[model samples]
Target: MSDKSIRVAVNGYGVIGKRVADAVTRQDDMQLAGIADTSVDWRLRVANQRGYRVFAATPKAHTSMSKAGIVLSGNLDDLLDEADIVVDCTPKHVATGNVALFRKRGLRFIVQGGEPHALTEHSFVAESNFDSAVGRYETRIVSCNTTSIVRTLGALKRAGLLKKARGTLLRRATDPWESHQSGIMNTLVPEQSIPSHQGPDAQSVDPDFDVVTMAVKVPETLAHLHYWNVELSRAADREEVLAAFHSSTRIAMVRLDDGLTGINSVKELMADLKRPNDNLYEVALWEDLVTIQNNELFYAYMVDNQAIVIPETIDAIRALTGLSTDSQKSIAKTNAALGIGSALY
Candidate 1:
């Protein structure tokens, strides 16, 4: 760990951006340089009220934000000038346009999985590939579902048990806050493709594994649940499969027998625990439901789409700045800072 703190600025203040900013404040080794966003709404105002120095994402946004009576530190360029690294949480395809400026300033950066892996040339999952990102200019933190896949399956692979995996994801229809504006109700929309983007994206972080994923967008907006049927290298006992998942600190084993019957139930538990935003950072696996038949193991888990990648983004910051040389050490610090290690059930 570094004796000094690294500066981090968030370029977007929406769902993922706001969470990333709050997670940064919890870290002893990181300082929030500032936050930049295009909207002149309550979200940006909340960032300012929370004591984060806020910046307008564009000159037009600057003028509009200033006129809207929201206090501003400066524009986007000014915010980047004060930071060692910036985590781009802007919407998909939108952040790509901002890359030229980040590169011009010689700043190390991290972008959400909304952006392509080719954009950064390196992808990160704290436990799986922290060392690869060390002292690197930038990396992409894969999306929520992808992050969960990597962490869970990556755990099994490390234990020398994984052979091949297939999963189906039940994704929330939309973010809770945005449900009013858009979302399908009383219906289920499947991705219409086999081996969804998530499967390919996970392999970007570690290319050796064989994994395939399919997804459906559900009517609710609480979180995502994935059913996985994995073929182990050998016929392992149920305890052995649990042991593999236990190897990952970020995997929280929950029990269906405990009455945490669905994704909403697990999310409600997080709220009961008083987690900020009621965030469930770890992959909440159904411990009692993990089943084994011959050489195949089956289980299901919930992925908190909004909060899962926050810790990974934090770890990427430490790696890019060389703040810590060890991957486990970095993950431990992030987990501690974010209250991430405890099991909900």
Candidate 2:
């Protein structure tokens, strides 16, 4: 434990785990203490990496990584005992069991993007509920859709100008691999299955702020998109709410093409955009006209649903540990560059 570093261990080295680990290693205040995975091949690559200590009961991936000139040197228990913070990017059900184990060892945890239920007494979104998560040993980032939408909503609500909010989320099935087992590679599958937490995750952030969600999936595997409808509690113009979303540093509200017809269906929306390779990197936004029919109000924003959530995961980790986002942004940006499309696409 160097005076300048906060040792961190990333558990479950799968897709989200790898992303989280890469982000942690690049932070000046944090050190990647190593990782634990059931995969023999993965452990070797991690073990072989230079400047990092990797350990495993099996030597396959560790040997491969070492042969490729990597640095690894610690076992699983060593990681649990040594790190200042343990980030569990494991699957939701597995996470619930493991989180308690980490706590028994007196370690603080960042419960991955899944399993808000594991949060028990932990906080929800970083920007919205981090004030509650800080100083606590455990907290969960809401599901990716919740992370993206709630961050935007929290920013908008905090501006003190909104009345009420309503939205629908079109999410990719990729989000469930580490947690929900039934949702991968399916199309047009709609349900309010996010949060894994019973209620929409947004109200967990702000109780008075009402939000309803309709979620759907598709064959395309790029990213999730959200159709947002917001009504300010107090009487206010739509532009004022749009301005609030636009001015937000955390959320990016995009421009809709004039010739673009409203996409009432998820399949058409994905096809219309051609499902760009780097969909998650860009915040997808589109405009829709509000219709006042039957004495009811309607409004919506089309958004690249996954864009803001990952950043918020980083934000939550930073908040829990008091790390500066400015210092960490460069590395995250670099990872984004190298990562480009396939990883997130």
Candidate number achieving the greatest lDDT relative to the actual structure: 1
Off by over 4 Å in 2: 41-52, 57-72, 175-187, 192-199, 258-283, 287-308, 322-345
Residue 62 of model 1 has an lDDT of 91
TM-score of each: 0.98, 0.72
Candidate 1: pairs in clash: none
Error (Å) of candidate 1 at residue 180 is 0.6
Q: How badly does each model clash, as a count of residue pairs?
A: 0, 22
lDDT of 2 by residue, 1-345 (tens): 347677788777765666666656655556787776555454336534534555542356456545655455655677777787777776656788776677788877777556754255554665566566555666776666666666566656777755556666565656433334545553377674643231356665657666667677664444565655566556556566556655544443333444444333433444455543223432434434543333234545444433434455555665566554342353244334333221111
TM-score of 2: 0.72
All candidates: CA RMSD in angstroms?
Answer: 1.3, 6.6
